[model samples]
Target: MTAAVRSTQQVFNLPDLGEGLTEAEIVAWRVAVGDVVEVDQPVVEVETAKAVVDVPCPYAGRVVALHGSPGELRPVGQPLITVAPLDDGADDAGRAGAGGADDPGGEPAGHAVYREEERAGSGNVLVGYGTGHGPAGRRRRRVGAARAGTGRRAAADDTAASTAALPEGHPTGTGAPVPTGAPAVVGDASAYRSRLDGELDAPLVISPLVRRLARERGIDLSAIRGSGPGGMIRRADLDARTGGPAGDGRGAGLAAVPDLRPAATAAATDAGADAGADEIVIPLRGVRKTIADKLSRSRREIPEVTIWVDVDATGLLATRAAINAAQPDRPVSLLALLARICVAGLRRYPQLNARVDGERGEIVQSGRIHLGIAAQTERGLLVPVLADVQRMDTGALSAALAETTAQARAGTLPPARLTGGTFTLNNYGVFGVDGSTPIINHPEAALLGIGRIVDKPWVVDGALAVRKVAEISLTFDHRVCDGGVAGGFLRFVADCVESPAVLIANV
Candidate 1:
């Protein structure tokens, strides 16, 4: 018996790609099955809630199958690649995460066999299996009223531990303040809320956010829930319940309310009756779909810890103004300026530019910096990268950024325009935010959030003076970096922003 040329198949699934360590959105495919692939080669591009990233191959073999079709939903641990072993033997189709062993779909392919130790550009080293356990822990849910004075709900993470350090310049969760004064019985809507109570096991299930929208519009989900599988609530479920097909439920309040003139028709008030037609109801496809996928993953995996720091951004603001005044013909926003600062800062503190290779069980430090810039669009958040940012001068980076964003906004951004970002920068500043503890893009150590820059009271030269300042927040993976390194990286970034001249690193 010629020992049946034992050839094994290696599989790679979508690895969680963010500090939130969440799911990924399949953005594009670089290769097809039946094609030969090398280990550490770019296989696909995925978008986290923050940036678009290229996931490289961990196996070197002939591509046998692909788990996710373009625009399809691929959960983490679901095989993404099937590679044939090198030998001619027919029995080698198994063996994935046991580091070079052959077992049929028994483990994740975090790193392909052969070159198992830490290697640059390897896809995220996932665990042998998916850890789909229930939510970890929760102190009683924070009520809406109790969440007063919250800095930003979208920015505050529920997982931030109390140990992370904060010195003022960074963004931290200032959870909505405790409700004060009277604890009055406020009654206005949904009886179902009290009916179901805590453990929601309704056959007709809908997220709280979705249910709130339905209640506000006077639309009932009970009828719609009946149409779905096991009474699951879908967007289309509610849509078809009404007379209009594909119509929005926003202004249906008036239609649903009964008329007092005819006692038979008297019902609830229509809060959004006849709202403008410009109002858009997004179907939550593509970019928005990407957001949902990533956010879900972040919440599922990883223990998150957040810290805040407040810095004197005057020097950085002055430098930005001076640079813009000097280079009037370029595309230089605070983001473009911040990217340069980050590139320089990473040179001083490489920890922020690194990622955790879990499957292969290694820590990686990247020498090059690829920056992802989060762009707000009609669809949702899309992160297009400014590749090799370290090599580009400030002016070159600014122009490239200008062109890339114009293309992104126009929906003309080519598929290539969205790939290969190693790190990300989300500028919430444009939205009037002072600071936020953003989730780091997966495989990348950290993500920097740029808050709105405004004049604020600052202690300058032993006196409180008005100074232009902005909040710079960094959310890093706790598994890969310690507070000392993360805080040091933040300090370096704050240094650059406080005085842009500091970015002139003697590279």
Candidate 2:
């Protein structure tokens, strides 16, 4: 027999996308198996809760396997792709057979093999995950000639363990028995570890908090199938299974609440048994899911108070008109003026431009305003930050805002642009709403809501006059300050809107 060829592979794990994000959804694959990729070459495009990012592979080699499919949410630190070295004389057929055609569910067999001199890497970092230019300190573990036989045996063991873990006669969601000698497709590596360690009863959970919650509620994790990437259970999945709000066990007592709606009861009774047919379920993922989670957390945690005032915006409108007329070629937007006003207000009342660090038991204030401007896009509501707005004038702010807004709408903003917001300014007036008790963006202390400016009767100089009027509302976290500070901030903003001279005097 000819000498056996030993092939080794390196696996790249998904790096943290920053801002404490735990996972990202695979939007598309730029490269497929058997394709050659250079170091730092983007192999996949992933959409995190904040932005769409192109994840580049660190290793320069031929791709042997892709870990997850498109639209699948992959947790950070999980294997993203597998790359085999070019010098390995494995043909395309051999490379394809690495996972074993008979073992269809088996993961590609190979440990991360780096060179003795140095580990191969791009040196170009993406977010927090990338290879570094450093000498390899550890010796490489080479698989012996028995690598193929060992992999096959491991696959058989994994398959048997998976089958034994399930209840008898239960379908494995595929409507067929798992093939022998094939490893089970799991949510993450932890599942494989659990099986190999003979801890089949142990649930695969990445979060300690989730485990604690399950323990507290006495909910069996093994019985529930995870809806997260690779069948890994998330907190949301637990909430759904327990029929309770996440973190809070209040949903446990939901049955104690009386259902007083007779009309709804009657409707349900009429549609009985077929009621499920009329229901349309939309799976929340990516940006939309992020929005829901943040908003819910904000509402639950923040003791928010909304204060509103109707301002005569005639002077503000006139000021904007004059500025645009003077320089028609470089016009400013009304939003820019409002942003300038917001900056001024925050400068005066710095308490509103801060976040509450609950863990530290301190109120963290910022010296510069990283203003978040809420813009509605086809993707969802995205707040792109304008860093250090205190340093930019109205014209500069306007130019930056326009460009950033365009990028946000086009879904081209990077993860950096979507975070580190110290304050937020929401121009909901574009949606024709007069006023709203908008939920504060979490971690940020306050949000300024601007409503539609329309012609309304105003008492100017104690006389009835038709003037452009608008409703301005401030929703602030009560943990930061009482109503006095909140009211002062709102009143100052209204003053700026009613009379541009007030804002100009401060500037």
Candidate 3:
């Protein structure tokens, strides 16, 4: 019998870090080439559109190569790391007994084979393996024996060429159908040209952005010819059809496009067209880019209405001081007290806590309260969410808010903790501002802005007296509720601030 052929090298692709992100900047690498790593071990740290996250490697093997350097941007589904998998043909006993002397799942000493099943992943979605949404099939393909003067690269090239050269709907030589959802590789240009020439009736369009562009521009997607693999329509194809409109036009708004492509790439492409010695250009990247895209979208899509109310915060301030004096060790923050009042108000006006699902034409009213606390860190502004805020008491809410704030400052909050908020509480008072018409965080229908609590002259029992006062503003989505509901929510919150007894009774 001829010698057995073994499959080894496996390339891991950069997985989607969620929030429909398409690319990420590699922050740092945890492992170097020739270093052995275990499954679910973090191989790299990347900064996505939402947050900085650690990407785990799904395969347990010796790292062969890394694709990108630190601070370099890599597209989703691109090669992230290459691993040489353990040989699979070893004896069953050897594979089974390969457990470590110290632990059951630990690495075995000596030359025993490691079982693939033994190196199972963490099942978490952020493994640098596959798109988290799809069935995660391995990127393994069997190759034929190498010819003279050709190596593994040549074999892979030949396989791709043969696959591309096959007639439409034809199978590979092994009678196996083409893999569905497999990433398209560089194939024979002549074969692609021939297919493009013959098949121009309906273009293969996959990107949602391309479809949206066609819908908006009244351009027929079927009428356009695609230059991508398998006749896939590309952004360039649409740009060509649109004649690539100039300077703050229909196309300019799409430049800082999120989800589809990196905003930096578009910004760079635009800046490259007008590179001048006197120009000072800054790249739209990382936290700044994310903020820009989100704010721009919120401004464009949201019909926001801002309403402000002045309140006597004397009772609220007294309650906070009394609580701190009673339990100095477990003191509650003033902001947390305000948050409690906001939560109580939301219970009375649930419409303020709900989101308007415009696509579905429905108002999604949340049953449970998940509050987003906006904090400014060195990186930028980030909102860390506290789940089930209605369950937390004053002390617990204060502790949770403090922990999240510290985590944000330390840049250690997980991406999951930064999302899924039904409502938002913005404390702009820390900056000593009296009031601001802050933009409502997208998807969350309303945001409550808290101002500084200061001593001001107020009417107390129809007499002018100095009292603790504050200004509160509510920015709400008009589509979710009308001015009446918005005013009621603000009035209820102001009442709670004015009389802490109302808040305690509601609680």
Candidate 4:
């Protein structure tokens, strides 16, 4: 044989997937220690700014270690995985231009990147290391774009570009990019401004989707400013600039432009959503990308089996109220009760709490249950796991739910909090939904959809009895379970919800 193709490890630090995204909530990891990964393979999923994203592994190798678990917030540039170089401990092999006088990774073997742009007359960069005591006023060319290999906090420091890295001489201000038609004097350029779209300039940092939206709406993206990181273009930026109901001032879907008016009735006859309405366009990055990838995978790869049921939740609600009163100060939600019920249900239908080893063509069933609570936030959807749900009581489940929601909203949830969920509980009831077919979170077998509880008249015993009723939908993996089993599992859930004491006895 000629020789082994030697390669070095590139600890691909997390890039700013979200526009000017400084941080992300780690949703899940696809690879584990000792698993071989191919380049471009989705290694991790994260949620950011209302969207989820999947980060593809840049290098192929065996995963040596993972930094954390799901729901954990990892800052940009943090090491997510450690890959063994193809060279196998040969430091000299495959090493490139990563050396710097002071590189934080201490690799001293990275590519050379111009950290600061040289302005026509400006002496140096705003931060340290750019200042040199030489020619009284020797200027540097601010023509080149800044090199960003790590997380750079892009603020609305210059112009309203959400993710703009300021020009050495550009007046400091945050609003929108130089109006769409503004001085096309410069090419599609970017640096680090965090108004909104600044951090999203992958390779070149241009918001292609946002520009496309603007063009389609008959509004020039350049004309509309940004209000996000580095002054990047945001949905609101476009909405405000276009006035409202964009284009013809009519309400429309994500594809329709915003109406120039604020009255809801103004665009009543339009397609849908304020597509071009009061909104700023943010290109999906980081967590948002992760979310998209996971959801896409779940919808695409697995054959989801959805089953719906309408249950009288009157008893469940009353039990919850009484339990809360008994444990005063510790509120218990219907979900807590549902969670306890689902955990117990899994005891009878173990397949729903299992994973498919596609590689081995075998199904791996888990005796213990890890419950994932589908959390909705301003950013997007996050399902932080309630590990060992089979073991927790209603009170413990209540505490976990409260803590998880609080941490999720605070943007302080840990990766561990978001991982290890074998079964997912999605409550669409909060939105008054009667029933819905939810997608299954893949690698796992099932996701339980909870619908709104309403006062519906039902004929019980003999006469008509008005009671609070809730709807539930169970979506499972057909490969791991059949309709008969899935239906039985859901019925078990309904029974527990109707009879609250079963949960206590099961525990």
lDDT of 3 by residue, 153-186 (tens): 1334435643543334433524454442222221
lDDT of 4: 0.58
Q: Who is ahead in TM-score, 1 or 3?
A: 3
- List the lowest-lDDT window of 10 residues for candidate 4: 134-143
What total of clashing residue pairs does each candidate reach? 31, 1, 0, 103
Arrange candidates by lDDT, descending: 2, 3, 4, 1
lDDT of 2: 0.70
TM per model?
0.46, 0.61, 0.59, 0.51
Writing each residue's lDDT as its tens digit, candidate 1 over 1-507 gives 123432345677776543543566564455543334566555665544444445666677655666775446576667777776544233222433232312222222332222222223344332111222211111112112111122111112212221121112222224323222101111111222222122133334323333444665557765454443334464445445543324544475556542222111111111233222344343454455656776666655545566666777778667777878887776376667778888877888787777777788887888888888878763455677777889998788888888777656544453445656677888887666798877655556678887877888998879999987777788877877789987888888887777666677634
**lDDT for 442 (candidate 3):** 87
Q: Compose the digit string of candidate 2's lDDT tens values, residues 272-347.
A: 3223345534468888788899899999988999999999999999999999999998899999999999999999
> lDDT of each model, Cα atoms only?
0.54, 0.70, 0.68, 0.58
Which ranges in model 3 have alpha carbons more than 4 Å from their true place?
A: 1-10, 34-39, 59-62, 83-279, 459-466
